[model samples]
Target chain A: MVKVENLTVRAGNFEISDVNFEIPDGKYGVLMGKTGCGKTTILEAICGLKNVVGGKIFVSEINVTALPAGARGIGFVPQDGSLFTTKTVRKHLAFGPRVHGWKREKVAGRVKDLAEDLGIAHLLDRKPHGLSGGERQRVSLGRALAVKPGVLCLDEPLSALDEDTHAEMVDLLKRLTAENDITVLHITHSRREAEQVADLQFRIEDGKVVQM
Target chain B: MIGARSDKPFLAAIGALAAMYLLLIVMMLVADAIYGFGVVPFRSDNPDQVSLVSIFSQKEVINSIKLTLYSCTISALLSIFVAVPTGYLLSRYNFPGKLLVDAILDIPIVLPPLVVGLSLLLLFNHLPTKDANFEDMLNDFKVPFLFPKGIEVTHNVLGVILAQFSVACAFSVRTMRNTFDQISPRTEQVAQTLGCSRARAFFSVVVPESWRGISTAGTLAWTRSMGEFGPILVFAGTIPNKTEVLSSTVYLEITTGSLETAVIVSLMMVTIAIVVLVAVRMWDRRNEGGLYHG
Candidate 1:
């Protein structure tokens, strides 16, 4: 479970004020808003990527507000896939596991399992430049899941895909969340995406998160 | 129709001027190299006179070449070591006095090389003097293997390396800063979320992505060090078999009225510069091909 209480963040001239929300354990929560409505800022703040001016962020009942982003154990997939162009898909999947001190053999085993589950096993040897948009997103998802975080944060993971790929991704995300029992805080601008995936929905209006 | 017709002649004139400028430089270099070849037979007329063959036969000239290679290589590598972190800091962070720090970094590049040499010389001149009491402390001070005589800078190999590095490092820092600026920060943030600390993320993600920029910066630093002259001349002095580099060799030859030897050294420098440039380009192309195919 992930919770933000009275969260206030200031970035440049913009401010997100007094936001309160929670994603209950093993549920898909979608934060929907118009563009530039501070949705991504909220996500970043929860993941410790952005500094919170006032309030606390709790992950699995632990107050991670003062923790560094790397210590938060929150998986984040940014808007773009942002895969390391120099590394192959296999290496990308193994990066997080290696960072968490997993041995080489364990990392290889985890990478194989993720690749098979994501249906990207065939593309393991390919670089990001060679992968299509859908394939890159899948690799990114695998990279995020490689660390086995309690809560996964996705910033518009399907915004770059076509309609067919979009539906396929939504289904895949739902299945993954169910199978892994992972809580999710997904941000999107599309009502259709929220309806298709969210178990609980929240909207950002005038820099506030309002549960709907 | 009239404007289009008028633009054609103007564009053609600009293109012709650029072509002429490029051809002029190539012609001058080729002419100088060929002229050096003609002086190969004149060495037997005077023992002090220099010819293409005699320049290589002279121990002083050969030693100068070796010294130039050693100092340039060391200075270039040192510049790269300093440039990587400095570039990353300047590229990624915003803090108080950032603009001031940036301006100071560029001072070496913008100032004349003679000024750089003069500044270094003045700084060394202010080194602590050994008094009777200090002599006891100095007796126990051990110098490293690279500095045999206890950290002497002026008129020494250390001075040569320092002078070259002062200018070379500035160019390297600029190149690496531009390289880091072009990379997206999202990749680093993602790495952090994946349990990698900031330093680990930089090494695993940022460094590997920037290999081309690192190569380009190193090449520029090496080439700049090879061509450095004014600073070394002013600071290091033209000490034969010690402080003398290829550039100093040319200057010394000219001072001794051996214009042929100066031309020979210049020709050798030009050849080495061309070979280094071509090799760097080929390596970049190979990496680019690997990125596309792999």
Candidate 2:
């Protein structure tokens, strides 16, 4: 569960005023907007990457406004599929659990299980340099989900894909999040992806959130 | 399409350049042999004593070479530690006097070694140092090894390291800055969202992503340190067994009319340079296909 009360952020002269929202646990909440909205800024502030001018953010009822980005249990995927070049897919998946200090045996089994489910089992040995667009996105999603985060924050996860692949990705995401009860705060201009996957959708125009 | 033939001219130019470089290497290798032949008549060693060629095999030559390696290795490591972070900071953020810091770093590359040595001489001695000048305390007491033995950075291996490090660190910082700049900072932000700290994201994501370019930079730094001469000579001097490096050794031998030993040391230095430069070029070739952190 996550809640933002009177969230206000100013990136130079740009200000997002009175941005308030509440995400119930396991709910797939989507931030739907036309373009140039406060969607990504809200996401960044929630993760503590950017400081809020005025507001309180809570992760599972714990105030996390002042907390560091790493301390907040949110898994994120950006618009671009930014995978590590030097690491294999398996090692990329091992990143979060390693940060949290999971044992070697535990990390291996967990990575293998996730790789199998994501259908990236064969691609695990490969680097990100030559992976196909869909394959890279799958790897990005797997990296985010590998840690089993409390909230999954995706900023236009399929924005960079082709038309056919974008549709395919939306379907795959719906199927993957079906049973995990992962709270998702997705930012997108695409109404199709937002409508297809979200239980509750909000349009963020300028800096305020309005129910659509 | 029509552009296929257009690139042929550029390709031809590159091929010609490669051939010229190869010819240059062959010429350099032969120059030492020619110099050695000219100086063979000089009284090197009688039947009782070892030959001049065997001077390279002597414990003094061997030990100086090893010490040179030691100095270069430690300096390179320290430079990377200090400079990599500086590079990342320069690439990612805009801060006060960034241009001034950049201009200062560029000085060592263009400046003479003697100037670097002289400047370091001032800093180690008493000449308006930043924050804490320890010269006052050192004057009062003759401290032992761990402490200062009465102001002694001139004519030492440590002075040599400072000189080489200033130049080598500039190269490392410039290369690594480009590497980090090429990486999209969005990836690190994403990692941060996934419960990875800022330091964690740097180590786990950015560093690994830019490792190939970073390795190439390190190779360049190592080769630069190996070929280091001027600053070492002025600051560290051509000490018989203590401070003499390969380059300085070659210089000393040539000046003292021991041309055979000079030729041998120069050959060895060239060989090491070729190996490292080739390795760096190989790394550049490997990554050119956009494979490793392009």
Candidate 3:
């Protein structure tokens, strides 16, 4: 479960105040908002990328507000896929587990499994620049799910994909998250994407998250 | 046809101006090489005809070359040390007085090299005079470099390195800041979410990505240090065979009326600089072609 209560975040000149939302355990949640709304900001805050000045954030009922981003145990996929430019697909998938001190064999096994599951086994040796937009997103998704975090936060993961790729990714995300029993908070502008993947839908209205 | 005819003079004028500037630089260098390689009488004491090889084989010239290489290497490494953090801070943070700090960082770059040298000379000479000054305080605290009655800095080898660092690091810091600015923070942020600490993420992700920038900055600093003359002349002094570098070797030879030797040393400096620059460019191109993997 991922929960935010009265969270206030300040980013540059803009501010989001009194924001509150929750995604129940193992449910897929989608956040919708118009351009310039605080959807991405809220996702960043939950993932510990932004400082929450005014409230508590809970992941798996643990108060993670005071923790550094690394300690929060949340997987984040930024809008542009934000894959490490220096790393290949295999390295990207293995980064989380390797950093967390998993054994080499375990990391390799996890990487191989994630690659097969995400249909990116063939592209594992190739770096992100070699991959197409959809392939990049799949690699990014595999990277996020590499460590199997309890909560996953995605910022406009499908915003750059074509219709066919988008639908395929939506199915892939749904199946993957369900199999892992991960709670997801995805930010998107498309209502169709939300309807397709979201079990709990929320919207950021007037700097507050309102359940729909 | 009319438009094309009208554009001829403008295009010719533009090409002429660029070609003229390039020609001047190439002619100057080519003339230096031709004259330097020519057998010119350099030894005033013994009038045995001297060539570039004989002049460069002199102990003083060899010492200057070694000092220049060693001091510039140290200065470039030191610049990297100071620049990486300073660049990251300037790139990523919004701290108080950020603008002021940024302006202050550019001081060495904008300040005249002569002024930088003079200022450093004065700073070192004047600091110990004041009661309870920073230098004295460091002395009191038994700092490693300051112990034993505060080791002499002005007119010393250390002064040469410091002088070179003061100017070269400014360019290094600027390059690094631009590099960090170009790279998105999103990758580091994602790395953090993947369980790497900020420092770990910086070293593992950001630093690896910044290889090209770091190389460019190091090369810029090193070459800048190599060519640094005014500051070293003012601060370190032309202590031949001791504090002398390649730049000061040119000055020393000129002062001693060995214009031929000075020109030869200048040619040597130019050759060294070109070789280093070409090597760095080749490395950057190779990395861009291959190691820039996605």
Candidate 4:
């Protein structure tokens, strides 16, 4: 489960106050709002990238409000699918596992499995610059899932893709998240994207998060 | 046709201005090359003039070369070590008095080289209490293996390295700060979210992506150290076989009326700088397409 309780985050001149929301375990949640409506800021706050002014964030029923981003056990995929530029796709997949001190064999096995599942096994040796937009997003997804975090926070994961690639990625995301039994909080501006994948839908309406 | 022709004159004016500087620099290099090779015997009075072979044969010149190479390399390395963290901090955070701190960091770069040398001299020699300066204090607690008599930096070889490092590191810090500024913080944030600590993320993500910048910074520092003279002259004091670097060697040669040898050494410094700059530029070009936008 991923939950935000009375979360108040202030970033420069923009601020969100007393926001509350939750996604049940193994379910997909999508948050929709217009541009500059504080969607990415909320996602950042949840992932521990932004400091909370006042409130609690719980991931898998554990209070992670005071924890650093690394200790929050939350996976985050930014808008650009921000993969480490120097690392190959395989290394990207293995990064979290290596950091967590998983055995060499386990890391290799997990990387291979993730690559196959993401259909990026062939591009494993290539660095991020060589990958297409869809490929990059898939690699980003694999990297996020490498450590098997309790909750994944994705900010407009398919916003950069073409129509055909977007539909394919949406299907891939839905299947993969369900298969892994991971909770998700995805941000998107597209209503069609919400209808396609969201188990629970929330929108920012007049400075408040309202469930749809 | 009229608009296009009018723009041509404006373009040519700027181009001519740019070419004037380039021509001046090229003319100097050409003059050095011609002078370096043209004269049969460098001095007319002295039949046995200093040739390239004779220059290297001298123990003092050889020692100066070794000192210059080793000390400058070490100074460049030390500069990079200090620059990386300092640059990263300046780039990533918004702290109180950030502008003040930034200006303070640029003091070594903007201050007259003589002032920098004098300040270092005073820092080591002048303590407020005045019981003993930092050097003497360290010398008092001298370890048998390390500082048998006393740790000597002022008027010592170590002072040569310090003087070079003090100025060179400022350039390195500036380069690294700009490098980090060009890179996005997005990848690092993502790394942190992947269970790597902030330090780990920096090492894994930011450092790897910063290779070209790091190399450029190190090279700039190294070249700066090579040309550093005023600080070494003021603080280290050129001792023929002890503290004499290539720059100091050139000065020594000129003072002793060995004009040819001084010009030859100047030519050598120019050649070394050109080689290093060219090598780095080529390496950058070779690895160009491999870099990511982030």
Residue range with the least summed lDDT across 10 consecutive positions in model 4 chain B: B141-150
For candidate 3, the docking band is medium
Task: Evaluate all candidate structures by whole-model CA lDDT and list the values in order.
Answer: 0.89, 0.79, 0.89, 0.89
When superposed on Cα atoms, how far off is each prediction in RMSD?
Answer: 3.6, 4.8, 3.6, 3.9
Q: Model 2, A1-212: lDDT tens per residue?
A: 98989999877667788988888988888998866666788888987888899989998989989988878888888777788776778877888888788999999998998898888888777778868888898889988888888888888888889989887888878777766778888888978878888888888866579877
Please list the residue runs of candidate 3 whose C-alpha ends up more than 4 Å from where it truly belongs after superposition: B1-17, B38-47, B126-150, B292-294
Error of 1 at B62 (Å): 1.2
What is the per-residue lDDT of model 2 for residues B178-251, given as tens digits with 9 covering 90 to 100? 88899999889877877777898888788877777677678767888888887787776778777888888888
Regarding TM-score, does 1 or 2 come out ahead?
A: 1
lDDT score for candidate 2 against the true structure: 0.79
On DockQ, the leading prediction is 1
Q: How displaced is residue A93 in candidate 3, in Å?
A: 1.1
Q: Summarize candidate 4's per-residue lDDT along B1-294 as a digit string, tens digits.
A: 655656778899999999999999999988877877675243344547667777767899889989999999999999999999999999999999999999999999998988888988876643223345566655644322333234577888889999999999999999999999988999999998888788998999999988889999999999999999999999998999999999999999999988778888888899889998999889987776665422
Per-model TM-score, in order, reads 0.92, 0.83, 0.92, 0.91
**DockQ order of candidates, best first?**
1, 3, 4, 2
